[model samples]
Target: MAKLIVENGGPLYGEVQISGAKNAVLPLMAATLLTEEKCVIDGVPDLADVKVMKGMLENFGATVVDDGNGLLEITASQIRTVNGDRKLVTEMRASTVAMGPLLARCGKVVMPLPGGCAIGKRPIDLHLKGFRALGATVIEDDENEQVIVTAGPKGLVGDAIYLDFPSVGATENILMASTMAAGTTIIENAAKEPEIVDLANQLNKMGAKIKGAGTDTIRVTGVERMGGSIHSVIPDRIETGTFMLAAAITRGEILVKNALPGHVRPIIAKLKECGVEVETVDDGIYVNARDKELIATNIKTLPYPGFPTDIQSPFMAFLTTVKGKSEVKETVFENRFMHVNELNRMGADITIENRIAYIPGGKTLHGAKVRATDLRAGAAMVLAGLAAEGKTEVSEIYHIERGYEKFVEKFTGLGALLTRVDED
Candidate 1:
């Protein structure tokens, strides 16, 4: 086990470059399975989940090479099977993304139920519903926890389908599978995230006709085959948000490079409401929280163009030091408030009622031992540690390392005195 030992309440001041979107890279890696040629992907973040996905692709016969500087060159030209290693697939939730490419290339795919952070129950019913609409026979073996799918009539004939919600994973899965289908497919209520648009751009470059990607409705025209090419993923908005909150919590100044200010508009608006100064330049965002007392603000986690659920926990940490009261309602997942208990350990005045958390701010927090319940929650703890008055020991630092790149180094660069200690 690993623990983060933080000396609290240090002003963060530096310029940090953001990495590529973790969410974007996972789906893009799955896209490599669409063709048998070499596909080079740039701006890939080094994370545990990425490593798991790479291992999964390698096990399924794809040759992968990483340049260690956010670039990956993958070739799936000689795939041996559509079935992925059950153990590897079960280790990461994004493993389910391979369903589309495998089904498109091999006409059959067998993968175990994917695994990820223990935030909430992320159902795959929407993904299955979309595949079934594309003429695929889906079978679920709950006894062994596997989803085995085989091609249906004419090998995945595309059709119109509607989603109850704009699920990001479902949208990407359907888009990839429909590329090789016989006809055009229209998806309504699709997720409009930048990552989805990145996927559409990559697919279109590979000869897939996808329009209206950054909107709720998307259209994909099937092609007989897809060819490979080089693609670059956009910067991670979630990582940008975390750093934005880091600046606010410590009353510091930070210039986050390569962050798309438009992608984080909702968060930016809320930050302005909380008395943080924000400025958007050509390729970076400058945040200054000096001499500002953060005010309480309410947040509701929705899909893209709205506040992201992944950043909610870190926002909660910011609220811990603010003056007045705030309410956070999480609509995306039922159990997303897992971080509340951990935050409370750090002397946070937070109360959870179902999915709603009411926080009264202006509390002088003295850090204590805390455990990270999930990935984002782990980040929340780090933020809280930076603003606390005393030492903070956060366990399960792996969750934090899984998403953020060189987290300790970034915080340290921003004047945070923290150490990653190996615990016995």
Candidate 2:
């Protein structure tokens, strides 16, 4: 176990380098499985989940080499097994992403239900539905707690699939599976996240034809085979949002480098709404919260181009240091409000009813022993600790480390005093 000890670090004043998108890199790692040649990936963040994916790929007999500096060389020349490791599959939710590539390449994939953060009941039904539409068979073995997917005799044949909701994972899974299908596959009501566009771009580089990636609809044409290619992942927008909130909470100035301004437009807009100064420059996103009167703001979590659900908790923490009241409605996940109690532990005045969080700002928050109930929640705790009156001991920091790379180092670079230490 690990814990982060944080103190009121005062106003931060420096630059922080944003890491590669953990979400984008995970799906991109899965994309490497679609080909047998060598694929080089750059800007890969050093995270636990990435290590798990690398191990999962190695489990399939793929040779993955770390060339340092966020560079990875992966070659899935031969797959030894179709059965996804039961232990590894249950460890991380993104493990399910390998199903599409395995099914397309090996014609069969067996994996247990994927496990991830307890944010919501993010069911794999959409993914299975898309798989079945692409001429694959899906069977749920409740006794063993695993899903078995197998391709037909003629393999996957593309078909028009419509998603009830724009699920990001479902969109990527279906898009990857349909790449080698016999015909054209059209996905309507697809997730329009920038990560999806990154996947489409990478797939297109690997000889897959995909269009309309950053929109509600996406089209993919089947090809005979796919070859490996070198690609660099986009910067992490969720991390970018967290850093922006860090600046706001501490009343500081931070120039977040390697950040994609377009990817975090919602956050930038919301910060400007709260009277915080945010600017987009040729290099990266710059946030100045020094001596500004940050105010309360109502926010509702939605998909891309909207306020992201992942950054909601961190923003809520920032609001606590402001003056007035704010409302946050979470429609994406039912259990995301778990962080509210932890925040309240730090002298925060927050109440929840019917998935709506009522937060009255201007509270003098004092640090306390808080547990990181989840990833983003952990980040919120860190931000809260930075602005709190006293020392804060944040437990269960593994969740934070799983997503954000060099988290403490980056914060410390900005003069935010926090340290990660091993706990006995």
What is the clash count for each candidate, in the order shown? Answer: 0, 0
Per-residue C-alpha lDDT of model 2 across residues 164-193, encoded as one tens digit per residue: 989999999999999999989999999999
| Each candidate: RMSD | 1.0, 0.7
Model 1, range 242-341, lDDT digits (tens) per residue?
A: 9999999888999999999989999899999999999998769999999987799999999888899999999999998899999999999888998888
> What's the C-alpha lDDT at position 120 in model 2?
90
List the candidate 1 regions with Cα displacement exceeding 4 Å: none
Determine which window of 10 residues in candidate 2 has minimal summed lDDT.
Answer: 82-91
State every prediction's TM-score relative to the real structure.
0.98, 0.99
lDDT of each: 0.90, 0.93
